[model samples]
Target: MAPVASPTLLARLLLAVAFAAAGVAAWAEHRADLARRAEGAAFAKRYSIDVRRPSFVETAKAEATGDLAYMPLVDAAVQDAMGTVALANLEPSARKAWIESAQELTAELAAARGLSLSGLAARPGWAYHAELLAFLTYTGDRRTAPVDLTAKSARWELPARMATRLSPGDDATWGFLAGAYLETWPRLPERTTAQALPILQRAFEDPDFVRRGFGAAVAYLGVEPAARLLPKTPDALRTARDIVGKRDVPAAARLHAIWETVERETREKDLARLEELAERGDVPGRRRTAEYWLVKHPPGEFDDENGRREVGRLVEAWPEGSHGPWPRDPRAQLVQHLLAGRLASVRGTALARLGNQLTGVPDSVRARLLLAAGDRYGWERILLESGGVGSFDWTRFFTELAARELAAGDAEKAEEALSRIARPARTECDVLLVRRAVAREAGKTAEEREAEAGLALAVEDRFGAERFAGGRTVSPCVDPERWADAALLVKVASPGVSLVGYGWDGGRIGTTLVSGEATLAVPLSGLSGRRSFSIATLAGPEARASEGWVTTSTGVRGDQPEAAQAAPLPPPPAP
Candidate 1:
């Protein structure tokens, strides 16, 4: 493997400074420069709607810790470009071409960010003329040019509301290439976005670009990418209030993006990672910000858990004793939770409140959520909100999947039919989808759901005590004692040797295997009898202590066995 490039020393030292100084320095320096430039009658010279130097900005682009002498030159070039495009008297054909040229430069002006695009002239493929042709080809506009250009006003002049409608800028962000890819997005997705990206995102690691692209792709998909490329959108309006209630980016925006991706794909999309960064993440700045956003947003115990726990990190993060329900909260749970009491008592509060708040949410959308909830909670008039038969399960999202399998549509799902927990149950009793859907989601077949009660009973019998350790920072596995859900515990032991159940991925963190029967009986308690022991931490290979766990020893400790004197170390047995 090629050696990974490290971030520059200057970058590491000034990162935080860059973030802070970026604000005040920009304001002060720009203002001071504006004044000095104004003294030179810069407005008259720079504002020409006709200066046409496409190569001009190339000389002005900023170099790290470099002077800004080139900024004015670039600005003048842009003014000229915009002016060239603004010519109202130009023929429709020419104007159309100019509009095409103008769009590229104008896209960033409203965001008022990023360095000049002058360097594109250096590479013919990326050259301004080449890009303009591509844009025309991409958008399929046939209009020609004699175009008069104008100021950079139209892009940013939209009402804040309309501006919000713009899909996020991928190019201007930490994920520039990703954004660039989207900037040229064909209104309809083709084999390119779908097929090309998975390969590219895996090999690319320019941090600011690749990681961001990977994240944005995941965001658009509404699912977790490798369980690391997304962030938890805090549902607590108050928790997210600082961002939504206060700042521009809602804490939930990240999570919502992930959830939406998952909901839409509803398939377990897999990726082969060519590099690992989220773990030993070398990216920072806006890239770091994007990475942080990704890290904080995956759902809880959410394996369609046993039930997905109601995530409230944002709520939890909100300082205690804060006031008001942050109404605009992006979190579904937060919005639902805050509206809890306002609902009627008859139907379960979720449906009732949701029914009352139907306008805020869509009717079809409400139906889907309510119907799914009803699958577990039973029907009610509260669920019968006005003109609809809620869509929570419409298009047969869950059952249709099962129906397809029974209908013999998808063999992979049929082959992989196994009952794992669906979603974490909030309130220890939130509606759970016991049946239906995908090779990855729950993988239940008609047979599984038909046998849901029986299979679930068996599942409950075998692994009901299987709730694993839960938390954002906790390992994917957990301790033996922590395993409580029936789906988790199993029983077996030796004369005194019986074992209970075992945890799934959620359980079994920190556990190590020691010498035991060919089919190791999960010890109901610790390994019993004078058996050999093998052990290791959750992250590595299970080790063998010279001595095994017993009355005086920790199975893991190599030191003198503690009060739990463990059995002797297991000999390296036959492979």
Candidate 2:
């Protein structure tokens, strides 16, 4: 029988069997897909969402870049379709229904991912419940519309309190209450405002609420009432100042009463009082003083006499020690460095004085001082001499020096500096850009000066570092490495390697695997005044590694300004 059946016939039979099995598997997969689609459609209809839209996918995937408005769509849909008159205010009948539906949806999603609703709430589900509560309380409708003042005062309070109650400590809670509180301000009924003022005032007394939702409360109370309600007595002001100094109070709302006191007493220009506040060890006080000084004496106001006075003031205020007792506030550090730079410009002995003054300062801060003074050689010297204190990066220093030279109309000097950067053709798109610029400025023949525009574009295309690198006629440097805490987008070529983030002090932050794109948002509160961060890729067998950093100032509410991003550095030059 084996001899009778040819090997070809046997091979064909096996192939036919495999195809039949594949057909059955494909049919099964298609049916399962249809079932999922049907279920998704039914859910979308129940919630009034267009599931076919790209936004729905973004919402479902819970992308950080997804529209905030889409976050509440599902809950809003359910509320609109199934919500009753009393449900709008989240009365017991409405509350129960909303919670049940929310919990059901959350549970379904969690089950799919082998998690619970609370676990999901800690991640993606946060936007749903938190935003829903914010929407219902803020607008009293599916969309952000005018609140019906006729509704009972308790109706709005129910959802506002429930937001925190549901998702405390999550970004969703803080973000939702932020919007909710702002909305409540304009629509707060006369009766509710009177009844709730004391409650809101008490809430602000807690450092937690102040950190999380004080801005909204301030908005809700209106400036005058908020000022009146905030601590006013000397002792109370000291205590309140302490809270603000801790950055527990929202930056704008922290010193409302103290500000009112300052404004009433000095029309907001009481530099003497502001300096006294700074002397009292208040961070916000230092910030306020720096801001006022910036306004009073903008960048071009630097002069010999003023520079001397400012330098003297900074030296006295910010004496150096073994990393002890230095003014840790970023704003203070900046003002001090700015004065140092001005002093360096005016006085030949400024570098000597600054070196003495900045002894024992943090490496990053010292780096800033050299950068500010435009002392490229000084920076280079520091980088070479300092064995472990973290030196100024050569590429950055050269890039800046070249730009300054170009700006000063010294094309030769600029070309020299640009030429100093190693492997300029491949290492940095900016370096190549500068090289082309210098060549053009030097009036080289078109053939001799061939602008490596194609090479720069290829590098940008390969690394996706265009945003940080391209279109720079000058230094194009994002300065002052310290940044407010915010999300950072990390893009890598492949998966598996563990990416680690670090705080300003070089402390290891949370880690994630680089499966392509990841967003890292570290809390600046614990980071204190040090907002700079570094990201490193830990190499493994399956990993592709690149190590680099970017800096930014911290944002309001600890938001990171857009500049706090790390672009992929160019790969190593071929051997």
In model 1, what lDDT does residue 369 have?
A: 43
Off by over 4 Å in 1: 1-39, 42-74, 78-208, 211-302, 311-356, 360-575
RMSD, every candidate, angstroms: 24.8, 27.6
Cα lDDT of model 2 by residue, 202-308, tens digit = 45544455555544554455444554555443333433443333322333233434543543334224445555665797756654564565444323222223333
Q: List model 1 lDDT by residue over 1-575, tens digit each.
A: 99765789668768878878888888886676555333223322332212333334344333221224324444553453345444687767656645554555443231112222222222223222222322222222112221211121121112111212232322222232234344433432465456435433432333334333444343444323323432322222112222221122222244334444453232211110101222354333323332233234433213222112222222222221212322342344433432222112123334334333323554433533454344423333433453543233222223323334534565465333222123221001111122322322445455444443332332221211122121111111212222221011111112211111122223221221222321221232321111112221221112111211112112433221221213343332232
Query: Candidate 1: deviation at residue 492, Å?
Result: 38
TM-score of 1: 0.22
Model 2 spans > 4 angstroms off: 1-368, 374-380, 383-392, 424-427, 446-449, 452-575
For candidate 1, give the lDDT of residue 98: 53
Compare the candidates by lDDT and give the number of the best one: 2
> What is the TM-score (0 to 1) of candidate 2?
0.29
